[model samples]
Target: VLAQNLVIQSSSEIRKPGDSVKMSCKTSGFTFTDEYIHWIQQVPGKEIKWIGRINPWDGGTVYSSSMKERFTMTTDNSITTAHLQIDRLRGEDSATYYCARDTMSNQGYLPYKNIPKQ
Candidate 1:
């Protein structure tokens, strides 16, 4: 699927320890089910972690080894949106998060990139 003029929007959140954080990725300029949406986390001074991805076409998802235990992935194709929710916020979760569209080829990702942390 060609994703010309694709745009994704998500907001920052403020949460206390042990709270849950639900982040959304609203998209435009493409059919939501035409591609997969992946979430990633970049903790300050650390490498990026792949949270997971959802197949809007079938509502199937895959999470990273570390994140699968505590994170959830969902989508609402009707709204052209995908979501990532962290079950328990810890100090380690203090970092920027991002929603990306898998370019669906060997060319690699062409995602929106960064969003503020919770």
Candidate 2:
């Protein structure tokens, strides 16, 4: 099985739609760039939500299908931080944002054996 971790990303600013926003996730269980970082948003009265995510090693981003084209995601491996920027202001942009990263070990990550198993 793969290993797992829990990282809490904290931010000091609440960004508007047109303003740029960034957050950082410091891993406590493993190395920094070995995994992926994901961003989420939950409304005032809703369950877990998905907004976007970024990969630190290559600075890759994946946004939700329903999100507008304005949302942007980026990451800096050197600092172990992820950034979420949304351009153009809109009332709907007001939300509680969350940032998360994939643990080095996952629940189903298993290695193969060199030989057949009995």
TM-score of each: 0.82, 0.65
Relative to the true structure, candidate 1 reaches a TM of 0.82
By summed lDDT, the worst window of 10 consecutive residues in model 1 runs over 105-114
Model 1, range 1-118, lDDT digits (tens) per residue? Answer: 2356355556557787788878777877767898988887877789777788899999999889889987999998998888888877777777777777776433433343343444
Give the best candidate by TM-score. Answer: 1
For model 2, name the residue pairs that clash: 3-105
Tens-digit lDDT track for model 2 on 50-70?
676677787777778876487
Which residue runs of candidate 2 sit more than 4 Å off their true CA positions? 1-29, 104-118
Model 1: how far residue 79 lies from native, Å = 0.8
lDDT value for candidate 2?
0.56
Q: Which parts of model 1 are misplaced by more than 4 Å? A: 1-3, 104-118
Cα deviation of 55, candidate 1, in Å: 0.2
Any idea how many clashes model 2 has? 1
Predictions in order: lDDT: 0.74, 0.56
lDDT of 1 at 95: 75
